[model samples]
Target: MHDELPVQESGPTASGSSPASAPGSTPAPRNPGRADQLDRRGGLDRLGWSVLRPAPVVCLTLVAAVIATGFAVRSSTAEMGILIWIDAHHTPALDGVAWALSWAFESPRAIAVVVLLAAGVAWRCRHLIDGLCAGIALALTWGTSYLVKLLVGRHRPAWTLLRHHVGGPEQDPSFPSGHATFTTALVVVVVMCTRRGWRVWIGAVGCVLAAGVAASRLYLGVHYPSDVAAGIVYGAAAGYLMVRATTLVSHARPDRRAGQDEDELRSGPGEIS
Candidate 1:
C-alpha cells in the first residue's frame, strides 16, 4: 500500500519542480557553426587555384612564342621588308609624335614613375595579399628587365647614333630593347594587380607608352626594326607571365591564422577569411 502511494506522488513532485530548482539539470548554450571553417577553406581554395593551376599555362605559352619569333627573325626577306617599311613610313610629323611620346619610356623618368605608381598601388591594396602582389610585380619588372638586358645583350638605337656622330659607343647586338620590356611589364603588372574600375584605362595608357618607346627605338635607327618588335613581344610575355605568377603566388598562400588581425577581426565570424 505504501509503495503504490509513493509512486503515484513521484510524478506530481517532479512536474512541480522548475528547471533552475531541479537537481543535476542545466540549460545548453548554442555553439559556433561551420561558416567560419567554410569561409577559410574557400579562401585557401582560391589561392591554390591562382598559384598552382595557372603557372604551367603561362610558362608553356612563353616558351612557344620565343621559339616562333626566333624562327620568324631567321627569314632575311621578311626582315628586309620590315626595314623598308619603317624607313619609308618615317616623316617629320611621325617623328614629332614619336619624340613627344618617347618621354614616358626614358629610363630614370620611367623608373621614378613606376616606383611611385607601385607605392600608390601598395597603399591602396593595403591588404596583406594585395600588397605582396604589388611588391612582387615591382620586383619582377626591375629584376627581370636587368636579367634580360644582360642575357639578350641587345644594343640601343642610341648606340648607332654615336657611330654616325663620333660621340657614342658602337651599338651592342641590337635586338630586344630593355626599355620596352620593362615598360610592358609595368603595364601588365599594374593592370593585373588593380581592383579599380578604371584599371583598363590605366592599362591602355601603359600600352600606348610602351608602344611609343618601342617606336622611338626604331626611329633612332640604332636598333633594327626587328629589334623593337622582338622587344615588344619579349616584354609583353614577361609581363604577362610575372603578373599571373604574382596572382598565383599571392593567392596560393593560405591564411591559416589571422592575417592583418584588424581586418580579420573586423570581418567578424560570419565573414570571409
Candidate 2:
C-alpha cells in the first residue's frame, strides 16, 4: 500500500476566511446591478454623442452667434439692465451662492490649480501629451482673456448705478470677465479628460456651473453683460481648439491612444481611474 499522504484542509484557512478570499488572491466580483445600469445609460448617451459628432463646427457657429449678439448689445448697455434686474431680485440665499461662485475661481490661483489637476489626469491615463496640451490650452485661454481686457480697456460697472453692492472693487478691466472665462475653459478640459460615458453628464453640469458664475458677476454689479458673453465665447472657442489639437496629437501617436483605450477597457463603467 502507498504511504498515507498528508490531507491538506480544503475549507477556510486559520484566518476563518476561505483560501480563495485571501488578500489579492482572487479578483473582486463586479456589481451586476450597477454595471447593467451604467451600460444602459452609457448606450443612451452614445446616441446623443453620435448626434453631436460634428461638435467643432457646431461650436464655431455658436461662438459666431454669441459674438454677433455681444456686438449688438455692446453700446446699449442692456447688460447693465440685467445687472439691475438681478440686484432688484437678490435674496439672501442667492447672495450667498453668488458670493461663493465669484470667490471660488479667482484667476492666476485658479489657473495654477486647474493646470496641476489636468496634469494629474494625464498621469492617471498615462498620457504625457494630453497633460501638456491641456495645461497649455488653459494657460492660453486665461492669457487671451487678460490681453483682451487690457486692449478693450473697459471700466467696471458703476457701484452707484447698482443700488446694492456685494463685493469689493474689481481693479481689472471689466470686459471679458476673468471668472467666466476661467470657468468655461476649465469645463472643456474636464470634459475632455473624462471617459465618453461620463462626458455628457460632466459637460452638462459644468455648463450650468459656468452659467451660474457668469450670472454671479452681473449680480455682483461688477461686469457688463457683454463682458461675460465675450468671455464665454472666447472660452468655448479656445477650448474647442484645444480639443482639436489634442486629437491631432493623439492620432499622430497611435501608441498613446492604444494604451489609453486599453486602460479604459480594463476599468469598469464610469470609473475614472
Candidate 3:
C-alpha cells in the first residue's frame, strides 16, 4: 500500500478568519480600509498634518506673539496717548492721501475686484489653489477681525479727539481696523497668488498701499494704534494659515511605512518558507 499524505482540515478557518495570534507577535492590522484611507491622505491624521506640514509651528508661534502684543497694547496709556497726539497733528495733504489709499486699496468693491482678478490670473496659470488660498486668507482675516471688533466693542475715537472729521460717521464697533487687516491680506495675496510677471511690483505696491491705509486710519482718527497693529498681525497670521492649510490639504507624498503596512495587509501573511 502507498503511504497516504495527511489531509489538513481547515474547519472554522474555512470561513476566512485569520489564524489566532500567538503571544505578542505584532497583531495583524485590524483595518486595512482605514489604512487605505490614510494612505490616500498621505498617511497622516488631520492633526498630524495640521501641526507637522508647512512649518505650522512657526505660524502658530507668530499668532501667539501677535495675541500677546495685542493684550499689551490694549493696556498701555502711553501708547494710547501717542496715537491721539498724532491724530491731532494731521495735515490736509496727508489726510487726503490717507483717505485715498484706504478707499483705493481696501474698500469692499476694491477687495472684490482684486480677489476676482487674482482668481483669473491663477486659473490662467493652472494654479487654482493659489487663488483659493488668497480668498480664504482675505475672508478669514476680515471675519476674525470683525468678530474681535464685536467682542471688544471699542468705539471709534471720539470725533472731538481729532482736529475734524470729513467722511461719513462709522456706526459700528472699531477695536480692530478692518482696512488695515484687509489691506495687509490683499498684499499677501497679491504676492502669493500667481507666477505672473509684475508680482514683485504688485507686492511692492500693495505694501505701500497697506502702510498708507494703516496711517489713514490713524490720520482719520477712527482707529487706535493698537487696532492697526492687531489688524496687521492678524492679516499676517491669516496668510500664513492659508498657505499652510492649503499645502497640508494638497500634499499627498506617500509615507513609506504606511505604504508598507498597507501592502503587507493586502498581500496577506506570507506562507512559511
Q: Which candidate is the best by lDDT?
A: 2
State which candidate has the highest TM-score.
2
- Candidate 3 yields a Cα-based lDDT of 0.59
* TM-score against native, each model: 0.57, 0.65, 0.62
User: How do the residues 1-273 of candidate 1 rate in per-residue lDDT, one tens digit apiece?
Assistant: 533322122111344442232334343222222232323322111222334666547655864565455445533333444444565667777766766556556567766766676566556544445445555665575566555445555444433223222123334444456666667777766665544455679878988878887777665454567666666666666666655566555544455563333223222221222
Q: Which stretches of candidate 3 lie over 4 Å from their true place?
A: 1-55, 71-80, 105-107, 127-130, 196-201, 250-273
lDDT of each: 0.52, 0.66, 0.59
Sequence-dependent TM-score of model 2: 0.65
Question: Which is better, 2 or 3, measured by lDDT?
Answer: 2
Q: Rank the candidates by lDDT, best first.
A: 2, 3, 1
Selected candidate, larger lDDT, 1 vs 2: 2
lDDT of 2 at 111: 67
State model 2's lDDT: 0.66
Q: Best to worst by TM-score, what's the order? A: 2, 3, 1
Span of ten consecutive residues with least summed lDDT in model 2? 41-50
